[model samples]
Target: MAMKAIDPQYTADTKYALEVRNVDIYYSAFRAVKNCSFGMERNKITALIGPSGCGKSTVLRSLNRMNDLIAGARTEGEVLYRGQNLYDPDIDAVQVRRSIGMVFQKANPFPKSIYDNIAYGPRVNGWKGSKAEMDELVERALRGAVLWDEVKDDLKKSGLAISGGQQQRLCIARALAVEPEVILMDEPCSALDPISTLKIEELMFELRQRYSIVIVTHNMQQAARASDNTVFFLMDKEDRAGQIVEYGPTEQIFQSPKDERTEQYISGRFG
Candidate 1:
């Protein structure tokens, strides 16, 4: 039997770094995801896991209003940041994005030199500081991404000149440079080698101390190993809209899921 939609719990008693409440995402009249709600704990990593086209990425993008860039994309209900609705007409999407930065599935670095790439966000956001201060900030951002030691001597090199893994880390560094409160990653490790993936996972653990994280991933083991909380999404043939079936602490979601569909998917019986 298929599972019904999870109730939209406000969870007002516990403070959340970010909250998606009773949201329905759509492209034109076609709904992609239906009535999703969850709260992200501060300084914790939350992973959204589901099959392809099940709207895990769609939900992730909605956190910062990234979906607004798409043609005909719209959302119903609220996506709250620090208890404020992001979709409120008074809110600026650019400001929202600045507060909650994103790293894509693929490594996308600018055509500029590595140093400039790291400094770009601060410059665009108007950092009122001296050259020395900007330089220190760049170095700090790179070091936070665990890439400073490797690229410090070659600051002038194009960000694209690096290997794939290094490029991905550079993107992470670039996102960090903005000093955002929450970082949304869309399958960040999907394109990396095993070693690179491990390094990224480890970096995530360290990053959670300073920033909240929400990641969309198809890798079950990655979600189980890297996330503090996990959300499971599924779509049935009768209704194409992706629905979140279960969500909870990572260990319980993996060890003993509340929904049979969640159990089946996590157990490798089906995706």
Candidate 2:
């Protein structure tokens, strides 16, 4: 059977595929994310674009609770997944991560074979299936990631054996194997060359057909081209905090943003 996603309608007004409601994140006594609230539509690509250290990646990691690993990193408010509060004490952070996947910049593939990298998730989750089934899942994931043709004959090769671009795609396939509902990517193309960046941008469009993708990127042009919605974050007056400066349909934000900071950032006048 095919993998079915959270319904499109349910992904929309039904609390969004992922909703960050009045979120406040702090590192020890210092606040990072202010009372931020946003809803991500289902199967859509939402780009979180901002300058360096503007908390774009922070928000992305918050979606999957990756920030919790930091000793003093604290989060307040709710990260709702399909209407359920992800921060609820009853929720399993591991389970939350499985359902909502993430890919980081630099294409940090595992030190294992390509096959093992993709199989790792399901295996740890007790897939306990036949070899054929595992093989099928691997191929399906690679194809979904648009990487099968480049890697099919060399599944036994170490993941690090591939080119930088291909390694990123392999990482993407690894995320896909679990069939997660959301894919949180942090500056995914920052480490790639222009050609590789273009390829990843194209991949982002294709991936959105099945998964809700939230990406944090410093490249404004990439955001304009790949995302359905754009969220622009900029540092505050103290330069110690960041907030969402502007957010709306990609067209609006790029064409005529409501804030002066957005225009400055988009036009490359200021950070």
**TM-scores, one per candidate:** 0.94, 0.94
Error of 2 at 182 (Å): 0.3
The lDDT of each candidate is 0.91, 0.88
lDDT of 2 by residue, 37-140 (tens): 88888889999998887888999999999998999999899998876788877677787888899899889999999999999989887787899999999999
Runs of candidate 1 with Cα error greater than 4 angstroms are: 1-13
lDDT of 1 at 114: 98
**Worst 10-residue stretch by lDDT in candidate 2?**
3-12
**Model 2 off-target regions past 4 Å?**
1-15
Taking the tens digit of each residue's C-alpha lDDT, what string does model 1 give over 1-271? 3432222353356668899999999999999999899988889999999888889999999999999999999999999875578898777788888889999999999999999999999999988899999899999999999999999999999999998899999999999999998999999999999999999999999999999999999899999999999999987567699989999999999999999999999999987
lDDT of 2: 0.88
Candidate 1 residue 257 Cα shift, in angstroms, is 0.6
Model 1 misses residue 247 by how many Å? 0.2
RMSD of 1: 6.5
Error of 1 at 199 (Å): 0.5
Q: State each model's C-alpha RMSD to the native.
A: 6.5, 4.0
